[model samples]
Target chain A: MGKPKKEPKIKRKTYIDTWRFLFQIGAFIAILVNPFLNYYFHVKVIQGWYQSIAFGHLWFVSPLEGIEALLITKIIYMPWIIGMTLPIIVALLLGRVFCSWICPINFFYEIMDRVHKKISKRSYYKRKPLFTLPRWILWVALVGELMLAMIVGKPIFVFLSPPGLVGREIMMAVFFHTLALEGIIVLIVLTTYLISQRFFCQYLCPLGALLAFIGAKRRLIIVQDMNTCHQCGFCDRACPWGIYPSRGEAEGIYCTNCGSCVAVCPFNARKFVFVGFTPSSEKLKLEKVPSGRQ
Target chain B: MKKENTSPKDSDKRNGEISRREFLRVLVGFSLTLPELAHAKSKFFSSPVHTNALRPPGAVPEDLFAGKCVRCGRCAEVCPYHCIEMLDIRHGLYAGTPIIYVDKIPCYLCMECTKVCPTGTLKPIPQEETRMGLAVVDKYRCITWKGEGICRSCYNACPYKDKAIYLDRLRPVVNKDHCTGCGLCTAACPVTPKAINIEPIYSFKVSKR
Candidate 1:
C-alpha cells in the first residue's frame, strides 16, 4: 500500500459521484424559496409536497419536536410520522449522506476547510476522525434527553436542533425581513470549521449524530483495489473527515459518503460498491485489529 | 530528538479509556437525573386552555395540546388563508405554536390545514363537525339586542348560515351545537364592541366538555 506500481489508470467515476452535488443544490433551493412562496402565494398552497417547504414546516426538524410536544402538552403529534421515516431509511441505506449532500451548513464547512488549508498549510484536524462515543451512544443521549425532558415537562431540542434553527433562520429572513440570533450561531459554526476540521459536525449536531447511528449499518462503502492502490496516502490526506482511506476497512459510522477520497485517488482503486451485491465483497468489510487490542 | 518511525495511524490505534457500550451506561445514568427537573407536565394537558386563544379548527384541547405540539409552524404554513400564526416568546410555554387571531384574520373554514397536520395536534375533523369553540353573542354589547339598529351581519357571515346562527326577531342568535366556532361571525360583527365572539374550546374556565 505504499508505492505506485506504475501510474494506475484513474478512470472517471460514474453518476453517483456528482449526484450529491445536484441534491445539495436542489435542497438549498427548496429550503430558500419554500417559505417565501408559501407565504405570498397561500392562495395556491393547495394540497401537496410544496406546502411543507414553509419555515415552520421543516421536514427534518418536525419529527424531533414530537418528544417535546408530548412531554409538554401530552399530545402525541402523530403527523411527525411523515417527517421521520424517509430520512431514516436513507440513513440505513447510505449512512449520513445528508451531511454531505444536503446540509447547507456543511456546504459552508467545505469552503472554510479549503480556506484553512490555504492559510495554514497543515491539516486542520490534527488527528484522524476522533473515535468519540460511537454513534449509538450519542443517539441514546438524544433520545434520553428527550424522554427525560418529556417526563419532567420541559421540552428540549426545540430550540437546540440545528436543522430546526436553519429553517427558523430561513423563515425569519423571508418573512420577518430581519436576521435573527440563529443566523449568528450558524455563522459561528461556519467560522469554527476554519479553525478546526469540521468541528460542529464532529462534536455537535444531534441530527447528524442520529443519521450516523442509523447509517452505522449501511450497505454502500468505498472499496479499494489493493492491486491498484498505490498507498501514497493521498486518499487519507484528501478526506475532510480525516479517515485513513488506506486502512481498507469497512467504513465506520462517521463516513459521510461524500466520496472525496474517491475523487482524490490518483489510482482508480477507490469506488463505492454495494458489498452484498457480489459474492467476493464479503471480505471487503472494515478490517478491525485483533480483539484484545483495546 | 531520537529517530522514531511509526506511521501516525498505527500509533493512534490504542482504544481510548471508555468503550462505546460502557459510555452509554454512564450516559444513561446521567439521563435519569433529567426528569427530576421536570415540572411543566400539566401545562398543556387538561384544558380550560390557560391563554383562551383561538386555535385552528380541529385543534386538540390546550392542556394536552401543548405537550403534543412541536410548534414547527407547519400548520401556519399550510393554512390556505394564512390565518395561523406561531405565538412568540410572549406566550411562554406555548411559544411557536399556532394560534388564529379571530379579529385580525379569522379561520376561513377551508379545512386545508387539517389535512396536512403531520401530528394529531389538529384533529382531522370535517368542517361541518368542527367545534373550534361555540359562538356566543354578547347581547349587552349588541345594538340589535338593545332595540337599536338591526345588524344581521354575524348571521350572514356564519358559514353554517341558519344552522350556526339565525336571525330571530331581527337579532342574530348563535346555535352552539351547530356552530363550528370558526369566528367568521365574530370577525364580521359590525358593532364597535363586537356582538358575537367564539369561546375557544381550551380557554381556562368552567370546563366546556
Candidate 2:
C-alpha cells in the first residue's frame, strides 16, 4: 500500500513581513524627526514659512468634501476632483492592503500591542463591541456631515480628524510652542489602539471600511487549504484582527492584508489567491512535509 | 470512517453558522443606528465663511475641508517664512484642524501649503492666482492719521510696489482697492495701537446676512 501523503510545513518568515516591519520602523522615525528637519535645515521649503507640508494640504481630495464644496464654491478644480475619485479605483484593484502595510497609525498600533502584551502579560487581546460601535457611528456622522454641508453649507468632520491632530502637533513643535494638548490627544489614541489590535483601522477608519467593501468581491483573497491545515490554528492566533483563516473565508471585512497570519503559519495551507479577476494563480507552495504524519 | 468524514463537515457547518450570525449582528447594528447618528452630526455643521467676506482671498473650497487630510505637517514643515501654525481647537469638534491667524502670523500667499496637500484639501493655486483679502487702514490707530507723528512705516512696508497706503499730500490714506491684504502693511504700521488690518471678504451669501 502506498504511504499517505503528509501535509506540507510553511516557513515562519517571508520577504513581505520583513519589508513591512522595516517600513514601519522607517515611517515612525521619519514622523519623529520631521519637526526638527523642518525647523533647522529648511530641507523641503514650502511657500508658507515654517509650515510642515503634511498638514496644510490634503493627501487626497475626499469625495464627501468634494461634492459638498462643489455646491458652495461653484468652481470645481479638476485635479482635486480626480484625486478624490482615485481611492475608489485603487480599492477595486488591491483591497485595503495599504492600511495594513503602509499606514503610520497601524504601525503605532502594532507597537502599542507589543507594549500591551508585555504590561498585561496577555498574548491575546480582544476588543469589545462598545469600541467597534464608534466606527460605524463615525461613518454615519461623516455621511450626515456631507449632506448637511450640501443643504446647510458646512463641513464638520475636518476638525476631529486624527491627521489634523497630528498636523497641529508638528506645527506647534516647529514654532517652539508647547504641544501638551496634542500630546494628550495622541496618548488617548495610542491607548485605544493598545487595547485593541488595529482598533482604528477595523472600527473607526471610514476610509479603511470603504476600501474593504469595494474590494471584498475581488478574486485576490487570502485563503487556506482545509485538507492541509494542521488545525494548529497558529494563523488564527497570529491574526491581528482575530480572523480564523482555516474557516475558508479570508473575506472578512476587517482583514488589513498585513500578512501576519501568513508570516506565522506553520503549515503552508494559507496563501493569497485571486479567484476571478486574474487568469493565472500564483501561490506559495510548501516543500517540506509535516513532521508527525505517517 | 463515515463518522470521521461527517464530523469535519458538521464542524464546518457550525463555523459557517457562527460566522453568519456575527456578520448579521454587525450589519444590523450599523444599519439601525446610522440615521440617528447622522441626524446628530448635522447639528455640528458650521456654515462656510463667505469667500468675499473672507479677510483673505484664497478661501479653500468646502469639500477640501473633509477629514481625508493626512495632516502630516508637510505644509508647516516646508513653509519658508514659518508663517502657518496648525491650531488644535479640541473643543466642539474643531479639535485638530489647522487655522492660520493673520494677526499672529500672516500667510504670505506663497502657495506652499497648497503644493504639499497630497489629498487636494489645500488645492494648489499659483502665486498670481492666490488672493487672501484686502488690507484696510485703521485711520484711528495710524500715527499719521491720528496726528501723533509723521510715521510713514505702512507706506514704506507695502509689498505692492505701487504702495496701497499713499500719503494724500502726506496725510496717510489707504486705497482699499489695491490692498492685497498681505499684512506687511499691518506689521509695518508704526503706532502705539497699529493701523492696517485685513478683514475677510464675504463672497458666499449667508442666511443671517
Candidate 3:
C-alpha cells in the first residue's frame, strides 16, 4: 500500500533481473558440481584451471594471497600469479558484481531473509557510515592486517571468508566424502545472516570489500531520477541489504547491484546506466534520503 | 504506561530502536568469536604433519612447500597411476596437500603430475632424475639376507635394476648412489612389513653434493 499501483501497460524489465538469477544459480551449481567432476569421472575437465570465467577461481591460494607464505615459511609459489590476475582485472572493470550475480552466499542469505520476515517482526539493520569509517572503507583494515601477517610470519585471514569456507567445504565433502568440523563455521555464518540482515555484506566480507575497493569508480551504476521518485522509502524495504537506493545518485561502494529495489519500484524511477560516457546525465542530481542517523 | 512483558521475540520489530541493533551487533560478534575458539586449539598443539611423509616427486622442501602449495589437487588428478593422495586436515598444516603412501599404492613415476603442477609446489622434474627419497634395506629383516633361496623380488621390480639394486651373494644390496626412491621395490618386495623403505628427504635435511 506504501507504493502507488503501476499501469499494466508498462512492461517491466524483469528479464535482466532473471538473467542475474540464472547467472547466480548457474554459478552456484557449477561450483557445487566442479569438485565432484575430477573425483567421479577421473577426467580433468578444467584441468586445474581454477580461475574460470564462470565461477572465477575457487583455489584457496592466490598470488595476491600476499606475504602470508613468504613471511611464514620464506617461500613463494611464483605460479600463483595465475590465480590472482584475472579477478583483479574483473574487479577493476566491473566492481563487486560477484556479490550480486555470482556469490552462493547471497542465495543462502536470501533464504534467511525470508525466514526473518516470517519469524522476526523487526527490520533493524546497523549500516552505512559505520562509526566514522565511511561504508566504503571495507578493505583497509583487512588489507593492512594482511601486510602485517606477512611481516609477522602468520596468515590471519586465510579462512575468514564465507565463500572460501563454502568452496573449501564443498571441495572437501566431494573429495574426502566427510563433512568436517569446518562445516560448523559455515552454519554459524548462516545463522548470523538470520540474526542480522546484510551484516556481513555491509560490514564484514573481505573479498567483497576488496572488490568494492577496486571497483568503486566503475561506470555501471544504479541511478534514481529524483524528479520521478516519490522518496516514499518502499525501495528501502525491498532492499535486502537495507540500503536506500535513492541516495546512490548512481554508484555506491556498498551496493551489490542486486536490483531488487529497482524491480519493486511502482513509479519506475530507477535505472542502471553507464555514467562515464553520458554528457549532461553524468551530473547526478543527488538528494540525501535522510539516513536518519544524525 | 510502560511495556513490561517485552520478550526478545516480541522485542521492537522496527528499526530506530537501538537495542535490537545492539543485539544484532552482539550476535555478529558471537559468530566471529565461535571460530576463534577453534583456532585456539591449533595454537596449543604441535603441528600434526607426519615426520616421514613421502611427498610426490618434484615437491619442494617441506618447510617451503607448506607456504607455496594451494592444494588444488591437480597433481593427484593427473596421475596416470593414482599414487598421490591429498592429506586431510588431520595431517595438520599440510592438510589438502599431496602425499604418497608407497606401501598402499606405489608411484610408477610417469612424471605427468610434475608437468600438471600449476603452482610449482611440485617442481616439473623428469622421472629419471627425481630424487623423491633414498630406499634403505634392513639386512636383518630381509628374507634374502636370511639365506632363504633369494627372493630377487626387489631386483626385478626396481626401475634401475642393476644400478639401484644388485645381487651380492644372492641377496639384493641397495646402491644409494643410483636410487631415485620411487618406492616400487619397497611395494613389490614379497614380505610383510617390507624390508626396504624410503627414507623421505623431508624427514632429515642434508646437503646435496
lDDT of each: 0.64, 0.55, 0.63
Q: Which stretches of candidate 2 lie over 4 Å from their true place?
A: A1-12, A45-75, A116-153, A180-185, A193-195, A274-279, A282-294, B1-57, B60-75, B90-99, B114-130, B202-209
Query: Any idea what lDDT model 1 has?
Result: 0.64
Worst 10 residues of 3 chain B by lDDT: B43-52
DockQ for model 2 equals 0.16
Worst 10 residues of 1 chain B by lDDT: B43-52
For all candidates, state DockQ relative to the true structure.
Answer: 0.20, 0.16, 0.21
Q: Considering lDDT, where higher is better, how would the candidates rank from best to worst? A: 1, 3, 2
Compare candidates 2 and 3 on TM-score and give the better one: 3
Error of 1 at B126 (Å): 1.2
Interface RMSD of each: 5.0, 6.9, 4.7
Q: Which lDDT tens digits does candidate 2 get at residues B1-209?
A: 99998898887665535576789999999999999777656533542232222222244533434333333445556666776555444323333344555655666667666766544446566554544656677777777777777877767777664556677866766666666666666666555455777655422323120
Tens-place lDDT digits, model 2, residues A119-229: 877544444333444445535644555565456443443444453445456557656566726466566766665456655555655555556767666545676555566
The digit string of per-residue lDDT tens for model 3 on A165-237 reads 5665676576656654555766776666644566567666666676777777876677776656766665676
Per-residue error at B115 for model 3, in Å? 3.3
